[model samples]
Target: MINNKTIEKFREIETPFYYYDLDVLRSTLDVVKKESENSGYKVHYAVKANSNPRILKIISSYGFGADCVSWNEIAAAIKAGFSPSEIVFAGVGKTDKDIGAALKEDIFCFNCESLQEIEVIDQLASKQKKTARIALRINPYIEAHTHKYITTGIEESKFGINTWELEEVIKRLPSLKNIRLIGMHFHIGSQITRMSVFKSLCARINELQIWFSSRSIDLKIINVGGGFGIDYENPDKSPLFEDYFSLLNEFIDLLPGQTLHMEPGRSIIGQCGSLISRVLFIKNGSNTLFAIIDAGMTDLIRPALYQAHHKIENLTSAGNIYRYDVVGPVCESSDTFAKHIELPETRRGDIIAIRSAGAYGEAMASRYNLRDLPPSVFSDDL
Candidate 1:
């Protein structure tokens, strides 16, 4: 949370910028590391969430592995001080250039999404005279009950390979001598608040494990991709990390000597960040009032992209409360943060804080509308 002192500092910066509470982030990482330390669970920070160089450096300093989905993300992780051996690449599509870059770096593993991807990597690895370790990313058909766009584990999603194709994939593996099938991966969705969805995934994985045992195959690693949700309503509330890790331990039965891995992004960084903006205009509407802000979907897109909500506050106001439809300067009608939200009577030039934006806030910002990108200010720096 930004204190009065921090709010004063915010007034100095330009209107629209990201403010990260490093104290909150470091404490959150400590909780994650302590909770996962019980079972030696390897956690790879998903770089897609927030690849800010400083954030990456801080996370990497804790010796956490990195999970990347693009060649540039892998390069970013390495540049941020994450070791190549601790980096895992996962994505539905990998260009030859992407594969070749990972091959040269000798990345930890590739979470292969299809048989053709495996063959392509094998071909590239053979040309480089190297062996590529891979994990078959399986679509377990589990419904995470999240937004449609964020769901990736369902069979209809074009993410991982369907379960029915497992046999054919195994059959075709003999011809690819340069690739090794190491582990299995599953990612149900993003912003997954339902615990039962993960339990269902564990059941499906157990069934898959039995099928693998029947084939006399021993999996060395089991990477259950992360989608733990954060408390958007309460920015100060910590996520249920201890309970989540405990639930996984109680339900998921691992084979002997099998290592477990996870990719957590939002739950670790979401609440610690906020987008501070200044109210540009206050206009009266037929029913509600409009508090137009300088920040737009171009700065924080979850509201426009996922229909997501973030807590809004009047940082410099303590007057009577009023209802407002907080909106941005973007031309899109869909660029709204909240509707009929209650905030202190706001005026133009008043600082407004959009809470719980650390994860996808600045990371997803764009140059849309030719708007300059928002700069970041850490709590420690303030």
Candidate 2:
């Protein structure tokens, strides 16, 4: 929630900036740390969610590991105080240069998504005279019931190794002496609200565990990639970390000496940040009132990209409520944020807050349309 004082602070700063409440982030991290620690589960903060240096530094301070998709993200995580040994690298299209860099860093493990990727990593490792630790990212073919663009783990998705290829991959592994298989990884999708989805993943993991055990494979890690959702409507409400951890403990059957790991991104950082903008003008559209905002898809692209919703609030007004189509200055018609949303009587220069933007908002920003990226503002600084 943007308090009266914070709104006043917003008036002093430039519009179209990201505002992060450090207290909210710390509180959310506290819950995650407590719940995961109680279950003896290792958590790797998904760096792609919000790789702001300050955000990364705060997360690393919690002693959690990092899950990175690129060598650049790994470098940022390391600069933010995350230990290289605690970082796990994952991506479907990892370039040769990135793989070589990760091999040199000797990071924790690579979540290998394809058979060819495994071979490449082995070759890279052989060239570097090092043994690369890897975990097979298996496609469980589970329905995440999320947006199609974000859903993975299906047979049609190019994100993970298909089940039919597992036999061949296993047969060829021994020949690649430079790599060692240590575990398995699965990420169904992002913004998954249903617990049933996770339960299904656990069941599949258990079945795969049995299959591996029969083959005398002693797996050491079970990494269920994170996709826990947050309440976008209610920005103050934190994610249900306790319930999520409890469900995993009840369902996933782990062998002795094995460890459970997760890579949470959105749930940890979504609620603590918001996009602060100002009403550029209040113009009449053909059928509705348009509250055009200074912030656009260039600053936060989730709405334009995924049709995602973020609660819009007029921070400076408390007059009679009216409906408006909140839009951005981007040239694209898809730059709309919310349509026919209720806000207090608004006008030009009124402060607006787009709630639940902390996770992918700033991280996915672009300089499209030749606009500058929005700067970040922390609560402590204000």
Candidate 3:
């Protein structure tokens, strides 16, 4: 949370920037490290969430691994100081260039999403004369109860290989000469608040593990992909990290030489960041008042894209009560930030904050409408 002192400091700077609370982020990372250390779980920070070089460097210093989805992300993780041995690459449509690069770098594992992808990687690795460690990404079809756009574990999603295809994949694997299938990976969805969904995932994995064991296949790693949601409504409240880790510790059964790997993105940095914007204009409609801001959907698209909610605050004013529909300067009707929001009577030039934007916020930002991209402001520097 930004205190009055921080707000005052922000007023001296420019509007439309991302303000990161490094203290909060460090504390969150400490808790995560403590929990994972206690439970003997290996954590990989998903780089797609917020791949700012500084943030990634800080996270890398904690000895966490990297979960990358593309070639650039793998490079970013490496550039951010994460060792190549600590990086795992996963994606559905990885290009041949990405595969070649990953093989050259000798990354930890490629979370293969399909049989064709497996074949492609094998061919690529064979050409490079390198044996690539791989993990089959299985689509467990578990419902994450999150926004549909972010859900990847459903049957209709294009993310993972379904159960029916497992037998075929195993049969075809012996023919692929350059890839070693060493593990299984499953990622149901993102922003998953329901722990039961994870328990269900664990049960499915246990059944699959037993079935594979019967076939004499011992998995060296079980990559349970990250989806731990954060407290968006109350950004100040710490997330239930202990409970989440304990749930995994209690349920996930591992055989000898098997390790549990978790990819956590939003839960680590979500609450520690906020988007700062300046009120552009106040418009009046028949139904509601609109507090127009300079920051558009291009800056923070979660609301317009996922219909997600973020706690809005007026950093410059207080006490006066009023209602407003917080909106961005984007030209679309869906460019709204908040609908029927209650805030103090706001005027132009006042600074406002959109809270809980650390994860997908900056990563998803674009330069729509020729708007300049927002600069990242760190509390550590202040």
Candidate 4:
């Protein structure tokens, strides 16, 4: 919570910056560690979510593995102290350069989305005189009940291998000498709020694993890709980590010596950061008041892109409640944050804290429209 005293100090610093609460972050990581340890789960922090150097270093200190999508993410993870063997690469598209780089690094496993990708990795690994460990990312066709844009496991999604292709994959696997199948991976979608969605996923995985069992294909890992959602309405509240892990343990029937792996990103860091922006103008419209903020879509695109909600608060104001159309200074009309949201009677120079932005906020910032990217200020620094 940004109190009045904190807001007073914020005046001395620049507005339109990301302010991270290290205390909250540490507490969140503590809970994640406790829960994952209780279940003996191998948790990896998804580097794509929030790769801020400070955040990554702190997470790495906790000894969490990294889940990466791109070559740069793998590089960043390595630079931040993540062991190459503890990293898992996953993406729909992988160029030869990227594959070769991962092979050179000897990353733990590549979550291969296609049989072609398996062949490519096998070819590259053979060239490098190294054996590549890979996990087949299967399309479970489970509806995550999240936003359509984020849904990946459905049949129409281009993220993973379809169910029909499993037979062909198994038949071709014997020919790929340099590539070893170590696990199977599944990711339904992002921002998954329903536990039932995950339960459905467990059932699908159970059904699919039988085919492998019949073939005596031993898997060392079951990498369930993460999409755990955080409470956007209540940023102070933690996600259901205990319930989440327990649910997996109770439902996911694991084979002997198979380890559980999850790639959590948003749930671990979303509540710990806020995008602090100053109110640039208080314009009165015909039937609404507009609180135009200095920060734009370039700084935080989730609101514009996914119509995602982040709790907005005027950290300085102490006045009568009033409704405001909180918006940003971006040229596009989609730069709006919230519509007709109630807040204190806002004025220019009022600092607004956009809550629960720690995950996708700073990591996704861009210099589009020549807007300068906002710097992050951790709570300890403040």
Candidate 5:
């Protein structure tokens, strides 16, 4: 729960900033560590979520590995105290520089997306006289039932290696001496709520494991990449970690000497943070009220892009209720945060908290329209 006294303190700070409940984050991390350890699963925290330095430091202290998508994220993970051996790099378009950096750092593994990427890593590793460890990211074509932009496992998506190409890929893998294929990686989508979808993924993985074993390939790691979702409506409830883990344990059959790994981003940190915006004006129309705020799409784009819903709260008002189309000062009409939102009679100086924004919210912030990005504030004993 958001501390009322902390909400009061927010009134003194300028609006359009991120407010993180560090206590909630610590508790969430505790549960994740305990549950994953109990199941003998290794967890790599996705760096694309909220890479705030303080937040990353806190997470690193809990001893979670990192899952990075870019060279900068690798650097950030290293700066946050995560050892290079604990980092896994995954992305479709890794640049030459990025590959060189990963090879230099000697990270754990590269989740290789395509045959061309595998060749490229092999070449890069050969140049540096290093053997690159890699995992083939396979496209299982599972429909994650999520937003189209975030889904990645379908045949049409340009994310992973297609099924038909696996045989030829393995044949070619023996020729590439600088790269060692270690495991398999799969990421169906982001913000997925259906546990059944993951069950299907596990079944597909089971079949793939048999196919690999037939080719004399024994995988050391099975990385079921993260797509765990959070309850955007109820931020207080813990994420469905138990059901998520149990589904994998029940369905995913592991070979001897193989290890299970999971990359969880949103499920771990999405609900622990909120976007704090201050109302600048309250314009009244014939039947609606427009609560114009200082924050816009540049600060939090999920509401505008994905039409995502977040619980909105006015921390100061208690009068009669009214419907408001909460908007920001951006020039585009589609830059709205919420429409037909119900709140108490709000004033010009009230602070509104957009809840459940710790994942994509801060990670996707931009400097469009020349607007400065909002700073982050944490609830801690400072």
Candidate 6:
């Protein structure tokens, strides 16, 4: 929530900036830490969500590990105070250069998505005379019931190794002498709100565990990749960390010495930050009032890319509410944020707050159309 004082501060600053409430972030982290600690589960903050240096440093301060997708992200995590020993690298299209870099750093684990990737990591590890720890990212074929672009566990997805290929993967693991297989990883999708989806994933993991045990394979880690969603309508409501951890504990059957891990991204950071923009113009569309904002898809692309809904608020107005089509200055017609959304009577220069933007907002920003990237403003500084 943007208080009156914060809204006043926004007037002094430039338009189209990310406002991060550090207190909100710390409170969310406190819940995550408490829940994970109670269940003895390890949490690796998914670095791909929001790799802001300050965000990463704050999460690292909680003694949480990091889950990175690229060598660059891994480097950023390390630079932000995340220990290399607590970082797990994951990606479907990891190049040899990245594999070599991760091997050199000796990161905690490589969430290998395919046999080819595992072979490449093995070769890279062999070249460096090092043993790379790996976890097979198996496709459980579970539907997370989220947006298609974010769903990954289905057979058609190009992410994890399919169930049909597991025999070959396990058969070939013996020949990859430079790599050690220590775990299994799964990421069904992002923005998953249904707890049943996680329950289904746990059932599949248990089945796979039995299969591995039948072959006398002793896996040491079970990483259920994160996709927990947040309440976009209620920005102040925290994520269901306690319920999520409790659900995992009840359903997943872990062997002795095996550790449970999660890679939460959105649920940890989504509510703490918002996209703050200034109303540049109040134009009338054919059928609706257009509150054109200075921020564009380049600043926060989730709405344009996924048609995601974010609660919009007019921070400076206290007049009677009216419906408006909140839009951006981007040339693309698809750059709309919310359509026919209710807001206080708005005018030019009114501050706008796009709630639930902390996850993929700044991290996915671009410089398209020659627009400069939006800057971040921490609440502490204000």
Best-performing candidate as measured by lDDT: 2
lDDT string, candidate 3, 243-281, tens digits: 998888899899988989999999998998899999999
Worst 10 residues of 4 by lDDT: 1-10
Each prediction's number of clashing residue pairs: 0, 0, 0, 0, 0, 0
lDDT of 2 by residue, 128-187 (tens): 999999999999999998888889888789888888888899899999999999999999
**What TM-score goes with each of the models?**
0.99, 0.99, 0.99, 0.99, 0.98, 0.99
List per-prediction Cα lDDT, in the order shown: 0.93, 0.95, 0.92, 0.93, 0.92, 0.94
Against the true structure, candidate 6 reaches a TM-score of 0.99
| TM-score, candidate number 4 | 0.99
**How far in Å is the alpha carbon of 208 misplaced in model 3?**
0.5
Q: List the residue pairs that clash in candidate 6.
A: none
Error of 4 at 146 (Å): 0.7
Cα RMSD of all models vs. native, in order, equals: 0.7, 0.6, 0.8, 0.8, 1.0, 0.7
Query: Over the full model, what C-alpha lDDT does candidate 6 score relative to the true structure?
Result: 0.94
